[model samples]
Target chain A: MAVRDPAMTDVARLAGVSHQTVSRVLNGHPNVREQTRLRVQAAIAELGYRPNRAARALVTGRSQVIGVVAQNTTLYGPASLLAALEQTAAESGFAVSVGSVRDLDHRSISAVVERHLAHRVAGIVVIAPVESAGEALERLPKDVPLVTVDGDPHRPMPLVTVDQAAGARAATQHLLDAGHRTVWHVSGPSDWFDSAGRIEGWREALTSAGAEIPPLVPADWSAAAGYRCGQMLARMPDVTAVFTANDHLALGVLRALHEHGRRVPDDISVVGFDDVPEAAYFIPPLTTVRPDFGAVARASLEMLLTQIESVSGGALRETIAPTLVARRSVAPPPRR
Target chain B: MAVRDPAMTDVARLAGVSHQTVSRVLNGHPNVREQTRLRVQAAIAELGYRPNRAARALVTGRSQVIGVVAQNTTLYGPASLLAALEQTAAESGFAVSVGSVRDLDHRSISAVVERHLAHRVAGIVVIAPVESAGEALERLPKDVPLVTVDGDPHRPMPLVTVDQAAGARAATQHLLDAGHRTVWHVSGPSDWFDSAGRIEGWREALTSAGAEIPPLVPADWSAAAGYRCGQMLARMPDVTAVFTANDHLALGVLRALHEHGRRVPDDISVVGFDDVPEAAYFIPPLTTVRPDFGAVARASLEMLLTQIESVSGGALRETIAPTLVARRSVAPPPRR
Candidate 1:
């Protein structure tokens, strides 16, 4: 029988490793162990498997495409970040391949990462913000150039994040400075890292001021959730100031306040996070904290490209600061 | 020397054709002419070359991953549709590879499509909504199974879209039914296919009702653009009812009305389209038309998958109807 072309599987079998390991070695992924690299090299030599891209990549040193694994692409925060990432990466002469995951489970993330690997992506920028990201991230091939945006900082990976806690603190402090007795907060889902940061920041501000802390109210980062919280807060006589985790929720609160005969800033002052495009148009014009997603994406892309070229991961923990935009939504609390 | 794997160039030399012709045959892409296919087949037979994925694909006939080419993913409509597409495709057992283009130019779209072809995606779903999409889509490899979501119907590809004209007409008719003499419109960028459809719908409603058609005020789907138009309308005493292309524009119009001391329903009535989650929470609550984006996503996925399984394309021109959600924003015009 005529000899058939040696496939990636053949090289893997000769090297006594998985096909993924062969792919990793061929792609010059930095995370592969020295011993496994030699074994894969020996196998490639013996089998004479001349992968098409391998030769070109040997001269070029890296692929032009980078992969982004983003979760919740429908949400404004994630979507805007993704767009920014793409734009910045393109400016750096790299095309982006995105695989959006519905869940942050280990298997799903692994599968998506593997798909990008198969495409010979030079690096990965994961944008999943759930608490489970650390575990999921650990499962990736160690040699892959990886940087995460909006992941837990406690993890060992390089991270680029928005200072959610700081923004929340500023919002709460702004309310308290306006001389409110206390600031009530409507938070996002507790599992979200952003939510955790915002909650901590709000708590820290309240504690520092010696203001009475209100019971925690949770929302799912939806306007509907904010509206529900608004209805409940409208019934409470002492609730004069409110901080929501995002602008959409603040919108719902404004509507509820309008229906409840409460004039904004006169009856209840509200501050929101995420100065989305429509923030200025909200009924009372939301006073919101703006996270610079473009800056975050640009910074994260820089780190990822650095890792792609260096072969050794570096310590890069960068945070983008959020700014507060003063609008019409804040005032001293109405007289008791 | 160890036996070397045969490269595609070797096959092309043996076949007396270009390397691209060899690749086309290997892909089972139906675009190759019969004579060229025969020559390539003979070349493969003589050279004894078999690609890794091609052999497997011939047996399995489909890839688990589908490709989506979306333009302007940062926008709410496209982002929501992408999320919906990802969820539905996953449930149906397909991973998605997305290539977002900055522009829908033929060259960019073609490059993205070619990249997906290299990844061996089962098919492609394009979500570009610009007027140029038809021409850009024509540049795609014709043999690839393609279904367009929210594209022009005149093109030769299957399309699944929301009836934009019907939705726009509904918004305008609502204002007219509220006893307005004429309904002015704040439109999205004229180049957008949705904008064109909405303009046509709005005009149709006015012509059918015998209402005087006012000049079109253009906005670029941003609140700032809408706010500028709103300021101009606020200065006109004859502007009793207004329809905005989307809810974001309506939000800005509301802001301008408030600044100009014009009450929404009492002095003027405003209606918006796209019942985004926050629309219900807009000041005075926005009355808008709700397009079932999830349904559109689901239907498009089904059609793309069906086309992938079958070689020949089927006729699928599906339109999801939008519904009007009445709220506090519209009322009978003030007595003359």
Candidate 2:
């Protein structure tokens, strides 16, 4: 007859202990007698037995896990925000598990949620730039409590978000007050709230000042895209001032302007958002609006834990504001 | 009589179910009847019951979790590397927990590890940067298996790291081939292996060329530091070329050069390591060495999992090679 695999029972028998004793040793129970534990461990090691994590989790009925669903795209905001969030969560005795979905389509987003479900997470936080996550949220089972960061406030779920509009307004007014005729805009993808909000603020500033609002050029939040837009704007003699969606884009704009023989602040003035860590090192030391990501991340963790506690015990909502960090990328419109 | 806090038992009694049945319902076990599950959930919600994660972990003897000890500093490599590692761990049906240390000191690093132990992690991945975490590793219980990433290869434990020295060599050689007499150096923190490896590669290239090797100016992987180094170098008439340790520093060098009235490629040429997404946006479009972090991350994960399986199944050593990406920043040294 085929030999039966030496299971926990056999290991327990070999170690002269009960099966429970062998299990205690396997699961890292400190209460086990060291000598007896060693014997059981030796037996198990000799038998090549591996305890199943899933089975253990099922019997316990608590997963000891928290899930974070985030975009794979390397934007400074999301990346930094997550780094801060993970650190905070770990301190609070929670594991910060993560899933990535580039697209906010139902399947992709749902896959993230379902994967978390399979792990049986205590809670889930979705971090994405797209509004489609809202639609995807509706598909989640009513039981799981969720907290979203950098998503739409209009969704029927608890959310923690930075005040994108206020940040944009601060950036735009900084340029407008510097006496530019109308600030040109290089925006991120239309679907992103940050891009749309910045556009609105730029338009609002121009409209309020009675300056003609120029059309915004759409670009992904990359330096290359900004350089392309900067190349186009450098050709326009009247384009003496500009505002970019982010620092990377601004870097591109600066590069393109130099190539076109337009000196920054002499031929044209510029402003950028997201005063990224490297922004101050830009050739002219970028004057950009810095978002208060730390505040947002802290608020997100608080909001998520609150909702998790409330939902598991009982859902509740919270919002946060973004602050502007004034720096050197802005100046008065250059004289013709 | 004084009222006892209604624990899981009270909820189970109120919902007319066994304590185990209540646990199944709370954990979203599919076997529980929907009606009974809803009743138990309602009782739980009404009573404001919250399960202690620690208590549950104690009973189950398995956490279904993994601890990730990473750097708290916001560097591109660590930030992106952490994100990639998290995604991989989550996909493998394990929760990725995180902790960060500002330094490699035993107290700071060990504290993070002990905290993870308190939560009962299945395994750990130490993203140790310096010689410091090795001390912390000694303090940890030997039974718990660990995998180190971007750590010292000579350590007794398994290590997974990217080839920083090779990437630096490629950057220096690229400059030499571009017709530069020799490349000067700007490096990251003295403690980090990345900084040291790049410095070695640069020195090796100069030594092999039989050229005079200059002393290394230390920077903390920031643009401001790079700019300061750049300012000093720009004034040196013989310093016609430079190789910065990272892209952020290269940006600062560009700024310092621009301020010093030196035209890139015309007055001086430069190359940077870590082709950050914004590298091409630099004034002259920085030429940089890009480390294959994705390959490193993938190999690290595979090595880590392999080691875990081997230890559990009793099986060996593994290593991976690094590659480089060449970009625009290198140019011929200007005529004296």
The candidate that wins on lDDT is 1
Once fitted onto the true fold, the runs of candidate 2 whose alpha carbons sit more than 4 angstroms away are: A1-64, A311-318, B1-64, B118-120, B312-320
Report the Cα lDDT for residue A136, model 1.
Answer: 85
Question: Candidate 1: which pairs clash?
Answer: A31-A143
* Tens-digit lDDT string for candidate 1 (B35-78): 98998888887865644332333235444567889888878898
What C-alpha RMSD separates each model from the true structure? 11.8, 8.9
Stretches of model 1 off by over 4 angstroms after superposition = A1-67, A92-95, A105-122, A139-141, A334-336, B1-65, B91-93, B105-122
> What tens-digit string does per-residue lDDT give for candidate 2 at B52-108?
444455465445467788885367877778777766776675556767776778898
lDDT (C-alpha) at residue B331 in model 2: 67
lDDT of 1 at B208: 100
Model 2 achieves a DockQ score of 0.24
Model 1 lDDT tens row, A136-221: 89877777788988799788889999999999999999999999989999999888889989999999999999988999889979
Clashing pairs in 2: A287-A329, B286-B329, B287-B329
- Judge candidate 2 at residue A94 and give its lDDT: 65
**Native-vs-model 1 lDDT?**
0.84
